[model samples]
Target: MTDQTPRLEAYQSKRSRTAVWLALGVAVITAGLVGGLLLIPRADRAEPIAVPTAFASPSAAETPAARATEAATRKVTLPAKLLSQPRLTDATLQKLADSMTLQFKDTAPETEDAVSGFYGNLAKQKLTMVIAIDAPVGNPASWASGMTHGLKTSLNAGPFHDVNPGPLGGSAKCADAKASGITIAVCLWADQETYGVLGFYYRTSASVTSDFVKARAAVELPTP
Candidate 1:
């Protein structure tokens, strides 16, 4: 029982210092392992798995269908004299053409390379106005149908009937329309490259079909 309190206190201090030294040694070992792992080369490390995503193909313009469309497309042209009528002189046709062009501009703002001409005798009250628009038409039949319907609506016309497209081989329709209390023979034609409308004043569709064919031939200069 000699100095038992001091001996007990000394033993406790020694245990506490030993525990702290052991904890510090473990901490240093863990830090060294972590540093070693960080020093490993990135190339040797396992790559992250890549998640697959939806793949998009090329655009329509680059496809075969687009090339075929390009091949099928052609350009059209219009001449000064759209007909061989003797009475419809160049000067008279030019004046009428200018007027029709103005009217066309007002109505069809989206038309491109548009041309218009007038034929027949105005004095006889028998005249025809030909309007041709040069552009790419994918479906000629559909275009003709739509144009015919539009013309009928604009002119307050009656039902249109199918007409022979002649040797041009596209689509055509004729309707009898009334404008200013006068009957008008309205015809529309569409091809791959162009579309046109004809207004034959004081005439019948049967009488103007041939004229329409001729006018179409004159105006539509297909690319060779």
Candidate 2:
């Protein structure tokens, strides 16, 4: 019989060629996958980013309410009571009123309009001067606070404590006035401004006009 080694060698060569072709196919597939990844669109491949815009600036002094409040606050005058005896003249009282930082009532009688209170002049240990306030049945604290600020400008506070909020008003009486040492209290009826002097004043006890002096009475207050 023949050795047959030559036939076996030819068969092994064919098998080696087949294995090389398979290896080449795998290499081609890997290369294609890498090329596809590189060719992908930037929009689809990249992370997203946000852009910012420029804003317009606001105008200066654009607040109207703050301006109105600033304008609304102004200088106001308050009235004071004068002595009945020893006859304090209009000129004398006017000078004192001017010096004491007082403003009289607009519709007050001519007698009261001119006569302001004296600081410390007394004949019989009784009060000779007092600041009159027109506090109605409502509150007069805002008015009082305003008055206190005004008074502090000229006079100084003393003893003889009064209610923090001069007084409360709920009556029908048209007008009421009170005067103590220097501060006066009053209360009247409500006409217009249902909550008249409501927002303006804080509740306070003041020594208002003591008309029926024999008694430390709770006098009726008038409306604004």
Candidate 3:
């Protein structure tokens, strides 16, 4: 009778141990799920990442397959319209170019008065452009379309949008060389590798936009 009693007690103890193990497993799985939820990306924002200088050069750090996949995730990086650089006068523009380490990459195509252009770095995989136009653009909307086309042709992402003129205000109105007017666009894009390019509207024709893009595509920029 005593031996039978001992065996019955042992069986109950083993069953309790099994229940404890099952509870522990459930807790671990629950913790893992909670961690996964925290790591998930937000819906509204793409992660801003470092992009390679593909638009400026022929090389990249990512694998070819990775580069191709990343290119698909890209979005518009620049504003559809120009941003007012309040003090973007000839003097101010000079300082801005100096700030970006301007180096003449090509001569402005639409000008004959020793028209030169510059290219420099604004941020990682992003570039700033400077083209000496013959005169400032009077009709921004018309010029913007040309710029959008130029960027689409130059960048891997072909589609672009321009911001409405009413919202940006009149001081931000179409370029006027005589009024010390200067129009600038800071374009950016999304993807695994982020990239940005800048376009400046001077007294030059819309054709200069494509020329500047092509020149900057092969030029070097300042280091951040």
Ranking by TM-score: 1, 2, 3
Name the 10 consecutive residues with the lowest summed lDDT in model 3: 170-179
Q: Tell me which of candidates 2 and 3 scores higher on lDDT.
A: 3
TM-score of each: 0.58, 0.25, 0.23
Once fitted onto the true fold, the runs of candidate 1 whose alpha carbons sit more than 4 angstroms away are 1-83, 86-96, 99-111
lDDT of 2 by residue, 128-153 (tens): 33233221211222322332332223
Off by over 4 Å in 2: 1-121, 133-139, 158-224
Per-residue accuracy of model 1 over 1-224 as CA lDDT, tens digit each: 57798887887675455334323432332233223323334443222233334443333223322333455444445455556543354453566566555654454423345676656654455566666765445566666655655554455578888888888888898888766556778788877666777777688887888888887777776557
Total clashing residue pairs per candidate?
A: 0, 33, 9
Ranking by lDDT: 1, 3, 2
List lDDT for all candidates, in order. Answer: 0.59, 0.27, 0.30
Which 10 successive residues of model 1 have the least lDDT summed?
25-34
